[model samples]
Target chain A: MASVLRPAAISRQTCSLVSNRTALLQQASRTRFSETLRTSYLLRESRCLSTTQRKSPSRIPSNDPVAAPFHTSARRQILPPGPQVIEGGVNDPAPVPPTSPTHGSYHWVFERAMSAALIPLTIAPFAAGSLNPVMDALLCAGIIIHSHIGFQSSIIDYVPDKRLPKTRAFFWWALRAATVVVAIGFFEFETNDVGLTEAIKKIWTAKRKEDSYVEPVLRGVA
Target chain B: MISQRFTQISARRVFAQRSISLTSTRFSAPALITACKPLTQSRPAATQTVPEDEAYSILKAQRAVRPVSPHLTIYQTQIPWTLSALNRITGIILSGGFYVFGAAYLVSPLLGWHLESSALAASFAELPTAVKLLLKFGVALPFTYHSWNGMRHLVWDSGRQFSNKMVVRSGQVVIGLTVVSSGALAVYGL
Candidate 1:
């Protein structure tokens, strides 16, 4: 309004409710201020305030030559909680993520190495023409680990933590616990009974109806 | 008097740029430089500045009506993507199987379940030959395909074999390998 600053007692209160960025944005939106007062100066000034240190309102000069600010009873507007939209705009920068070989490229390398290792592992027993129980258990565990990683990726992609926080967390921990239990099962089968590979071999060669010593058929075979 | 007043504004204009970024510093420095500036900007009464939150509210209203990003169902299927989809599906099947069997095996010791190779084998052997081959083929299809396609993925991850032709060719090769190996296993194992 043309009456931008009236001759009134302006309160100098430290802005405690909203961020300085909000205040800065509010100030920037009024481009007409520069048009009426110092042409084009405030327009350029507001833009440069987007830097990190601008959040501190302590730097605003308490005194100046201009007309004084006054207290108004009108309520200031605030952003509402949207369902999918996240907090902060492009100006608000994310925290710098910590980087190391273990969290970065090495994880990728480890995945590839594990995948490459599996190829040799798959052929090793067949090339030697023997079913070593230890070798069989190791391979099964390797596959489980590989599967666990893949499943985790799927969970990350589909059950995003942003959209479904609780469900994502549940699926993650459940998968981890399930993986550990399955590993245990695989090991037990290997130690106390004929392991996974041998079970496949036996089934492939199995020939008769009356061969089971147990009376009931097993359910839930993976 | 008018010329003198214009001269002061011209002088202030010369140094306005240096103080542009400094809101607090700009006010405090008038003593040092005598740069005359108004305490408040004088805006016209007609146009108004919408608060940041109000602008966001307008944006939020627009977004609520905006269509979401299209899901995979809207996609046109092709060979490469189909093969990629199948690879993932097979991976899920294989991993899911391992989890189930692993749990069963773990509890087998406690339950007195004869999940030993011979017992499971004998149980499976009771099925008719056709059913047996069919079962093997069904399981084998996913297993063999997933395994071979996994190698293809590993190769692709290395940033090689990314051409459209190579992807299609490799996919076909994987399918062929799966059929031949799975068929041989079913027949020979039988």
Candidate 2:
């Protein structure tokens, strides 16, 4: 009886050992295959990969939801860490620095200030009726500069250098020329005509002494 | 034997009642759930367009690559951007005021009005001192601001005072000068 029991126990132990070895061998081969699959996925680096090609059912049990390929695409469609160029043969543009050199851009501050100043410079004379050459000259300079800046800003906002590079250049030069002509005309008015303030004042109280008339036309007749 | 059987049947009835009461309390929640289950099951399942997912991804990618302007909503507004925007706004206001007023002045001659007349002058003089001062100040405020800001801009054009600290400092100085100068002009003009 002891001899029979010993042989039976020995056979049971051997069978268990053989089964354990086979399981381990199977697990090793699965892990090796999964590793190879992962490397292939990395190499392909394709934007779109089919579920069967991408997923490897390594750790998940066969009955698990993730072990199947049905929802693999949904799981894979996650936002990447940063911008990814999925499409082939596309290169990102190099980063460009800002055009303005200043930090807070004092020019912008000054521009605002100038615009604010024009209100007082203009109205003080209108309210007071005190027209001096000094005031006129100042007004002349302020109006010219202020208007130029305003027009320039409008041009810049509308005509970006990126879209119409040459047009932008042309407009800039044209604007400068226009500004020069306007400035000259204003200066001429300042020097020659009843100055800007006086002219405005004259216009304000201007009275029409006569009815509007056109010169009588004469034509040659037989 | 009949009495014994009757006693057993009574005990059995009490035990059954107690079990029914306890189990009813315990399963009441599950019963409510079971009641709701049929209603949910009656509804049709949602269908998905699986094939269009590829097209959706491609469209999404295209959107990601598309060039878009930096809209005002997304960016953090800074002093430079704000101030520049204000400058443009003020410029428009000032220019518009000039054009409108100038046009009115030009057309006044045709309308039979004396702009330089003594009556108009006398009327202006008749205005209260406070009103006069207020008007002068109103005029001076814009003048002072615009002039000082323009100076700050000129300094910038020269490529000096480009640092952050300098910009802030200069901004404060410009405001200070505008206030002081405008106040002085307002008083003197009044």
Candidate 3:
């Protein structure tokens, strides 16, 4: 009887010991799986850093000093794809914008310079109340250029490429065409007529009958 | 009878002890609980599966596809932006006003009011000197401000006066020039 009991007791002790060992092994594996995940994350971060560093130098060309800083590639960094998704959820990464330089700093600078030049161009005419051909030509040129710049800026603000790309392009070209036509008409008027400012002065100073508009009324009255 | 009841209670106690020993696995220790807490807490609850209704999903998708531009109110008002906006406003008003007056002058003859009519010139000539000066100032003020501000923007185009100090300085200078020049024109009728 004693011998039989001893074998049963030993078997029970071994069973408990086996379970404890298996539990310990599971714990160790769980820790190792976590460590591998952490190491992979570190590796991914370093890879991203190296890629951005490598791409920047190539993207910013040496010739384009004005566009170097503002280029889309230089301004933004692409993030890595996220971990796997379990659910049928919307996990699409954000859209990556295409890289291109639309305009240079010099373009904006020229717009501003034209604006400054208009001050003297407009003021002298108003103050003198006379029409000199040189001043009139300068005035016409300045007005056309200034309006073109102003309209372009408005177009850029209200009609961004991201929202309405086609409309933006269409309006931009339309503005250019309109500016050209208007400039041509203005030059014709400035040269053939007494000129813009002098014409305005004439309207102010003319007598009721002598005024051009009054000639038709006088003819009708008779 | 008492001895029999004692034995029954002892037997039940032994059964409870066996069940307790079976349930208490080594993995369920206090150390394991602490280790698991950090893992659970590190990830946010939103990372878990969140069931959404079809309507909600559609709305979210729409918002994602057509994201709105930031509103004008979001930005802090600065001198250059404010002045530039004013310049555009004044420019539109001045030009529109000119076209309207010119059109009126052209059509006045058909209505029996002639552009060169002595009555109109007489009415204008009879206005009090102060009222005329005020009227002249009103017209001159917008033109002067717009022109001066345009000059400031032009200076900005030259890549100078871009810094905060220079921008502010130029803005002050423009305002000063507008006030001085317009006041001189109004008072002296230059």
TM-score of each: 0.61, 0.39, 0.47
Q: Name the candidate that leads on TM-score.
A: 1
lDDT measured at residue B178 in model 1 versus the true structure, 0 to 100: 88
Candidate 2 per-residue lDDT, tens place, A1-222, comes to 011123332323233333364464455445545654554343233223554544443533344221112111222323322232343223856656677735346767666677566667766885789568878878878877877777787988877675467878998998787666566656655665567777645433333232112212222231
Error of 2 at A204 (Å): 15
Q: Write the per-residue lDDT of candidate 3 for residues A65-172, one digit (tens) a residue.
A: 221111111121232212212233468666666754446656655766677777777768667887488887887677667766767777887676654578889999
Error of 2 at A83 (Å): 27
lDDT tens readout by residue for model 1, B1-190: 9988767644444344343444445354444345544432222233568999877766555444333434455678877989898988898998898798888888887899887788788788889989999988888888888889989999999999999999989888988998998888778667
Please report how far candidate 2 places residue B40 from its true position, in Å: 35
| CAPRI level of candidate 3 | incorrect
Error of 3 at A127 (Å): 5.9
Query: What tens digits encode model 1's per-residue C-alpha lDDT throughout A75-157?
Result: 12233222455458879997577989897799889888877878876777557644688788778878987899889878987
lDDT of 2 by residue, B1-190 (tens): 9988756544433333343244434444435334332211111112356565565565445444332334565568765656556556655666555544444444455787554334454455556667766766776676566666666766786699978888777877877887898778656633
Is 1 or 3 the stronger prediction by TM-score? 1
- Which ten-residue region of model 1 chain B has the weakest summed lDDT? B37-46
Question: Candidate 1: where are CA atoms >4 Å away?
Answer: A1-83, A90-96, A128-130, A209-222, B1-65, B109-112
